[model samples]
Target: MINYLHREQILPAPIEKVWAYFCDPKNLNEITPPDMKFEIVSGGDVKMYEGQVVEYRVEFVRGLRSLWLTEIAHVRENEYFVDEQRVGPYRFWYHEHSFESVPAGVKMTDHVTYAAPFGLIGDVVNAVWIRQRLNGIFDFRYQKIVELFGSVK
Candidate 1:
């Protein structure tokens, strides 16, 4: 399996504020890069209760489109949420999002474990570019958070 980790801190904001923003389905497109053209096709509920499933369609570079369906496995209000892939671009995808209250603000952590469809070939591709692409997604998300919340410091 391939793993990716991302961490960010938003200053002067409580965990609830950050959690609310992230859990809102409408904000998914806002944080995604315009190049990807990510859009939620179903399950646009703003509140993430357990067992919620969200379906999304993404247009990759050159109009390559893929459908992703994810289900919320676990949730702790203002604390953490876990989403596992029911169907998506990858063979396996599980993301854990956690929020911790800090003196300055909220520290958010994203842990993603995924695997491609093909076996060895997929591993090689992930090692080379897929991992980097995942990181880029997080980088875009970080900037979006800052834009939505304003500069922390």
Candidate 2:
């Protein structure tokens, strides 16, 4: 089964500046929670581009590290970009980050479609734990972005 997650935030910054920040893979660590221990193991120095493959080392649960490999599947300048999992814990993962210029500033949106490993058991785990964990991760990202860029006002 595929699960979806969506979140939107408006920042008090121009679309160009916001796009630059999000397009750089290195900046991901800054927005992610410290406890997750998210780090780019390779291919993060250069800015994102189509077919770019990035590797990461992450500890989603404390002390349990996992290697995640993803490819930048699509890009459209300051409009949107998508990253799909090539190798990771998830059975499938595709994330789209979109940006638009709003009257207040830039409206950023995150849309994720993913499925956990296993079958019925995975769905049960997702319902009991994974879903909440994903929500918390995005919540941290939203707060961190607001702290870094300031809220739309």
Going through the candidates in the order shown, the clash numbers are 0, 0
10 residues in a row with least lDDT, candidate 1: 3-12
Candidate 1 segments exceeding 4 Å error: none
Off by over 4 Å in 2: none
Q: Clashing residue pairs, candidate 2? A: none
Please provide, for model 2 over 1-153, each residue's C-alpha lDDT reduced to its tens digit, 9 standing for 90 to 100. Answer: 999999999999999999999999999999999999998999999999999999999998888999999999999999999999999889999999999999999999999999999999999999999999999999999999999899966
**At residue 34, what lDDT does model 2 achieve?**
94
Q: Please provide TM-scores, in order, for all candidate models, with all chains considered together.
A: 0.92, 0.98
lDDT per residue for candidate 1 within 31-131, as digits (tens), equals 89999988899897667878999999987545798988999999999888999999877889889988889887887888887887688988888889888
Best by TM-score: 2
Q: Which lDDT value does model 2 have at 46?
A: 100
Each model's lDDT comes to: 0.83, 0.95
